[model samples]
Structures are given as structure tokens and as C-alpha cells.
Target: MRVMAFDYGTKRIGIAVTDPLQIIATGLDNIHPNNIIEFIKKYLQTELVERFIVGEPKQMDNTPSQSAQHVKGFVNLLKKTFPEMPIEMVDERFTSKMASATIAQSGMNKKNRQNKELVDTISAVILLQSWMDRRLL
Candidate 1:
């Protein structure tokens, strides 16, 4: 079973997954927030995901950010929808900026770098990688 991660937002939710060996995280997709359950159900039919890491929005002062309420609601829905699945919330403070910077530094074309979906996917990947790194430390 592999690990999965999500960068949840009101507009779009980003997805990432690790290889079966759990060595690396890769961006998977960006989907509408409302479609997550159905998307997950379809994905699970093809792959075994043992754990999930959801981005926890937080302010600079370490308090939950305004968006945290939405994330909380999503977490509740996720828990109720898949009672047996394991879930974790990891602080996601500046993943978007980091993703944007990484994309810019990668020499990606300006048009592609401007893609919100790509940024979301990379943010999810960053979230998962950080969680995995923390585990190894």
C-alpha cells in the first residue's frame, strides 16, 4: 500500500502519492473539492492507499488559519466517508510559494508556470515529501 496526500482548497484539491516502496512522492492530479470522494473511490479501485496526509492551514502565529475551517469540514467528511482509513494533518504554511518558486527555477515556460493546477499538484507533493521526511528524522 502507498501513502497519499492532499492539498485541500475550496476550489481545487491537489493530489499526490508515493510509490509502493514509499520512497518518493509524485504529483497525481488536481480535482474539484466536491469530487474528492468519488475520485478517491475510483482511485482506490486501482491502487492501495494505506494512509493520507492532508494539508493543515495555519497562520504565521501557529494558529489555525481561516481556511482551516474548510479543511476541518473536509477532514470530517473524509473520516465519515472512509472510517477505516488513516489520516494525518500536516502544517502547510508556504507550500504554494515554494511550489511556484520551484517551478520558476525549473525553467518551465511562463504559461505553464502560471497554471494553478500545476502549483496545487506540486504543493501536494511538497506536503507529502515533508511528512515522509519527518518520519525518517
Candidate 2:
């Protein structure tokens, strides 16, 4: 069973999908926030996803951040759309920072680093990979 992961943002939503065995996650595309629900619904109809893992942003103090509520709403939408699929929240405190650091370390040009959509996709991969690791343990 494959699992889909989302890194929800105000303007864009990043997507990633795990292997059928749930072993690895690959970054997909960043969809417009306004069209995320439709995109997800279409993807679910075409793909064989079994569940969803949404990144839950939290402050350094472990408190829910503003983005967390947005993510929650997105998850709620997914639940309403796909009533049978299970949805889980994974802590995503530093995934963006990690993605940025990784991009910086890779020596990407300034223009690439500044691309929010690209960074968001990478962050989604980070979020999904972290969830996959935790599930293995």
C-alpha cells in the first residue's frame, strides 16, 4: 500500500509519494493551494494510494503553529473526500530548514535556492522520509 504525503503551504502545496512497500518517498510536484483538493482527488482516482501523511508544522516550543491549522484543514478536506483513507500527522518542525540546508550544501545556484516551489517539494520529501523512518521503528 502506498502512502501520499503533503507539505501544505498558504500559496502552494508540495506532494510526495511513498513506494508501494512504504519504504521510500519521492518528491512530486507543487500544486496551487486553491486547487489542492481537486488535484488530490484526481490523483487518488488515478493512483493506488492507501493513506496520507500530512506535515504538521510546530514551533520550536512544540506548540502548533499557524501553518498547522492550515494543514489540519487540508487533512480534513482529504478525509471528507476520501472517507476510507487514513490520514496521519507527522511533526515537521525543521523540514524546511533541512531542505534549505541540503540545497545550500548541494551548491545550487541562487536562483534555484530562491524557488519556493522547488524548496517546498524538497521539504515534502523530507517530511515523508521522516515519517517513513518513524514507521519503521
Candidate 3:
């Protein structure tokens, strides 16, 4: 079954998709947070997505951050919009940092690294991959 993952932010939401086997997650695109439900509707019509994995931002102390509230609101909207699809949340404390590290290691320039949307997309991909890996274990 295919899976879609989201890294939701106040201004933008990053999208990623997994293959039918649910083994790999690829960065898709960034969408405005307000347009996420519509984006999901459009994407679901084109792809056979079975589930959604959303990142839940947490503090270093493992407590949910303020951003988690927004994510929860987004999740609620998602559930209302797609009642049939399953939704799950994974801790995403360091996914952004990991994404930045990965990009840095790839030899991208400082200017490229500063692209917030690109970093958000990469973080979404990493979050999806982490979910897949956890399921495999």
C-alpha cells in the first residue's frame, strides 16, 4: 500500500510519498498549509495512497512543542477531509537537522541550504523513511 507523509509548518507543508511496497519515501513538493487538504484531495485522486504519516514536533525533553498543536489541527482537518484514510504521527524532533546535515554532506552551497522549502521537503522525506524503518523493525 502506498503512503503519504507530511511535514506541516505554519506557512508551508512539505509532502512525500512512499511506493506501493511502502519501502521508500520520496520528496514530492511543498504546499501552502491552508491548501493542504485540497492538495491531498488532488493527489489522492491521482495516486493510490492508503495512509498518511505526519510528523509531530517535540522538544528535546520529549514534550510536545507548540507546533504540535498546529499539527494536531492539521491532522484533524485531514481526518475530516479523508475519513477513510489512516493517519499516524511520528516524533520528528531532529528530522530538519538531519535533512540539513544530509544536504550539507551532498556538497550543496550555503545559498541552496538556506532554501526553507527544500529543507522542509527533505525533512518530510526523512520523516517518512523513519516511519518505514520503524515498521520494518
Query: Who wins the lDDT comparison?
Result: 1
Better of 1 and 3 by TM-score: 1
Model 1, span 1-137: residue lDDT tens: 89999999899999999999999999999999889999999999999999989999999999999999999999999999989999999999999999999999999999999999999999999999999999999
lDDT of each: 0.96, 0.88, 0.92
Question: Which candidate do you rate higher for lDDT, 1 or 3?
Answer: 1
> Which of 2 and 3 is the better model by TM-score?
3
Candidate 1 Cα deviation (angstroms), residue 105: 0.6
Instruction: Judge candidate 1 against the unseen true structure and give its global Cα lDDT, from 0 to 1.
Output: 0.96
Whole-model lDDT, model 2:
0.88
Window of ten residues with lowest summed lDDT in model 1: 74-83
The predicted structure with the larger TM-score, 1 or 2, is 1
Model number with the top TM-score? 1
For model 2, how does the per-residue alpha-carbon lDDT over 1-137 read when each residue is reduced to its tens digit?
78898999999888999888888899989998889878887877778988888999899898999777788788888888789998999998888889999888888899998889888999999999998888778
**Candidate 2 Cα misplacement greater than 4 A, ranges:** none
